[model samples]
Target: MTERRPRKDAVRNRMAVLAAADALFNRRESPEDLTMADIAAAAGVGKATLFRAFGDRTGLLRALYEARLEPTMDAVKAGPPPLGPTTPPLARIPALLDALLCFKLDNRRLALALEGTAGAGPYRAANYERWHSLLKVMLEQIPGMADSDFIAHALLAATRADLVEHLAGQERVPPERMRTQLAAFTARVLGTRPTPGSNAED
Candidate 1:
């Protein structure tokens, strides 16, 4: 005997739930606090239907976060200058940092979630690695930077969620000071030897 397939209503309901979750999480920076009932309400379906569609919060967050972050880095890796290819190696490092700081400020929770290798599993790890790879490639293009890839990995580590939270959230450092420090630190690691031109000392 043949198995029965989901009806069109089931399919539409599933898509709507995913869409609602993605909008809430990605656009508004909502966390896994979103519930099946919330998704069902947003999707105009019942709670049981959302469970049947997404299984659990982890499953939905994983799928939706992957869908968002993977393409995000892709655009960063390919779009125009300052973010993508075609920017000068020296300028690109600081530019990337600026973009990243904005991203962190906007998606602070999701960025925090990616820090631990657990829970996120292999897929999130792969996304982190992708960000590292793009950064390393930009570094490698710089002249005399022999250990650019290794240096890029180090830069990535330095910009992690723990440090960002401590410095910005707890210490309450001013945004300009933070930007100057990050650019200086990143530039130093990449061996760019910053000029003493109007930046915070140390």
Candidate 2:
């Protein structure tokens, strides 16, 4: 059966809601405080429209997060070495971790808001599972790697949105430094030497 496309106004409303949500998240320090009404008002749409389009707060967050993640996800799926499928697992794993860390850092507020929702814990989140499954596959490819599943989880834990927020917000860690630390940690886990000039300590 052929699927019917959304009406022009529905598409426009979705885009407007996404844009307004993005702006609100970027502008606010605590995105968790942002309500559906706030985003509806900002987008000049009715609250009913927001709920009808997104179903609930969690659905809206997932949509917005996925929209923001599209470019990075594209690069990871088919772009050149380090993230692309063509790269060696040994190299690609770290690159993937680095990319995830950067993404969390860049979208800290949105990440925190989404991750903090009830029933949306990191372990069960669809996006988290996707990355974990990909990382586990890569880890299995590397020679002599053990417990790829647990390793994938451990590696991803380092870049959790809550941890990122704590490090980048409360601790005020520099972005470069966090990247360096993550790279060094990933290297250690993969049983490889750390990159030049990178160690466990600052």
Candidate 3:
């Protein structure tokens, strides 16, 4: 049989389904609990159409994570003063943590999901490797900083959302408190002393 062309309404319905799923998963604390029917009802589409748009629940979740993670990434990259590209890496390093801290507050679940996937598959390998390389470049700016590679690994480990979640949830530390120390500590690792009482809010 010949391939059937999707009707205009069908295309619109699929986009609606994915959009609804993205919103629900990103906004909720327990995104993993979302079901296809829940997504369809929210989208005003039939369950079959939801599945057709996304092959499985995982695909839907992935779609949602991608849509929402941009703000988190963008925040760290450009939303604020020191974190934005206009600032030197020395300032951006600590500011990245502050900007990312706000992102963690807004999109913690999606942020955790990205962090969880950072080292498993080939795609993740490429992303992780790229970030590692970027940190290595940042380290080059610091005179005589030992073992840039090792330090990069340590810095990444310290700043991850999973670690933050543990600190915030299990350790009962407030997110703001953890972010304060995390940003200050990250700057120290980069071989720069944070200026006393210097404001670095993103």
Candidate 4:
């Protein structure tokens, strides 16, 4: 069976919505501050078009979040070490954590909004599930790493968007410092210190 492609205008509308949403998120302090109507107006589209393109606020957020996270996800999935699968578990784990931290930090408001949205809680969110599953699989490969499931959850907790926002926005922690602290925390959890120059660049 053949599937029909979206009309060109549909594709253009989706892109415009995403771009407008991205801009809104960047300019606003809270994702809750922006609404579908605002995005629709910004994109020069009708509110009905926004809903048709994204289904709901949560859907729009997920679309924008995925669009922003795509590059990093691509590297983790297939690019070279240390984010790539071919890297040793010990190296790759920290690299992955670092990448996730940087991603949340870079997309602070959007991440916070998406993860906080109704029907998209952290446990059930697609992005969180993917990271947790990958981290669990990697942890399982390491000898003596007990309770990979819990460990992955615990490790990811440190990178939660709200926590990142607190440290970055309230405590004024520099990005490098946050990255260092997270690396140290990951090492302690893994019972190993990072090798020199082993931390992946943000």
Candidate 5:
């Protein structure tokens, strides 16, 4: 039997739900403040429809997060240097961490909500494993880098959503400054000297 496609109306409703949820999540300080009912209302669909489209609140959040991450993930996978396959591992390592940090900063509340969910933290997420594996492979390519697996995990820890929130929200560190600090710290971890005039020190 041929696979049945989703109805056109179902596709439209799904898009509406995602767009509404994206807007609400972006405007709110915390995703915990929003609900499936709220999303359904915002999307002009029944709560049942929302649940049917996405199994639950966690599922919805995962879909939204994945949608937002897709472009960046694609770039990292196949785009130009610094994030693509062509960049030297040493350069790519720091670049990847920086990209992750920026992504966390941009999606602070959503990242926190998703990563802090019950029964499944950030480490359990598929994207987290993908990033860890990528970082580990790159670290392995660098001369004298030991324990690439542990090092990759350690490096990623610096960009955790909660940590980014703590530094950006509570501490009020400027975005550029936070990036600089992370770069400096990453350089130290890799035992590489920072580039001259690089804000890694600032």
Candidate 6:
């Protein structure tokens, strides 16, 4: 016997819940301020449906975060040069790090909430592993680059949501300056001088 698929309305309701949660997350001062009930009401679904769909707040946050990151992840996986597999390692490494930094910067609040969720270390996250694996592979291709695993972790550390929040929020660093700084930093880790004018401050 064939198994039944989710009904069309069920799929639509799921999408609505995710969309409502996304909007609520962006509008609220903090994700902690939003509740499952609030999301259900906004999505026009019942509280039971929300809980059944996502399991819990952390699960919901993870789903929403992943949804938002899907586009960039797709680019890194199979899109154009600099991010895709076709790009040279030396160039791709910095591009990957820069992309991650920009992503965290753009999704500051959501990232902070997702990473800060109880029992959810970014290192253990599925998306984090995908990025680390890709970076490690790229680093291994570069000449004289030892400890690619550790190096990948270190580079990802620089783009952590809390660190990005500190620099962009409390320190008031401009987005362009932040990107340039990360580019320069990545270049240093890869033992290459950033191209002239890439550092923004140069």
The sequence of per-residue lDDT tens digits that candidate 4 reaches over residues 1-202 is: 8999999999999999999999989999778989899999999999999998889999999999999999999999999998997999999999999999999999998888888874545777768889999999999999988999999999999999889999999999999889988988888899889646646232
How does model 4 score by TM-score? 0.94
- The predictions' CA RMSDs to the true structure, in order, are 5.3, 1.7, 5.2, 2.6, 1.8, 1.8
Candidate with better TM-score, 4 vs 6: 4
Residue 22 of model 3, lDDT score: 69
Instruction: Name the TM-score of candidate 2.
Output: 0.94
Reference-based lDDT, each prediction: 0.67, 0.89, 0.67, 0.90, 0.89, 0.87
Q: Write the per-residue lDDT of candidate 6 for residues 61-158, one digit (tens) a residue.
A: 88998998998889888999878879898888877788888889989999988888745557766578888898898889998899999999999999
- In model 2, state the lDDT of residue 79: 93
Candidate 5, residue 167: how far the Cα is off, in Å = 0.7
Clashes of 5: 0
TM-score for each candidate, following the candidate numbering = 0.68, 0.94, 0.70, 0.94, 0.92, 0.93
lDDT of 1 by residue, 58-147 (tens): 556555556565544665669787667777878777777666765665555655655543354332454567767877888778777778
Off by over 4 Å in 4: 118-121, 197-202
- Model with the higher TM-score, candidate 3 or 4: 4
Task: Please report how far candidate 1 places residue 85 from its true position, in Å.
Answer: 0.5
Give one digit per residue, the lDDT tens place, for model 3 in 67-101. Answer: 65566567555676665666777777676656555
TM-score of 5: 0.92
For model 1, name the residue pairs that clash: none
lDDT of 1: 0.67
Task: Give me the displacement of residue 134 in model 4, in angstroms.
Answer: 0.4
lDDT of 3 at 67: 60
Error of 6 at 163 (Å): 0.3
Worst 10 residues of 4 by lDDT: 193-202
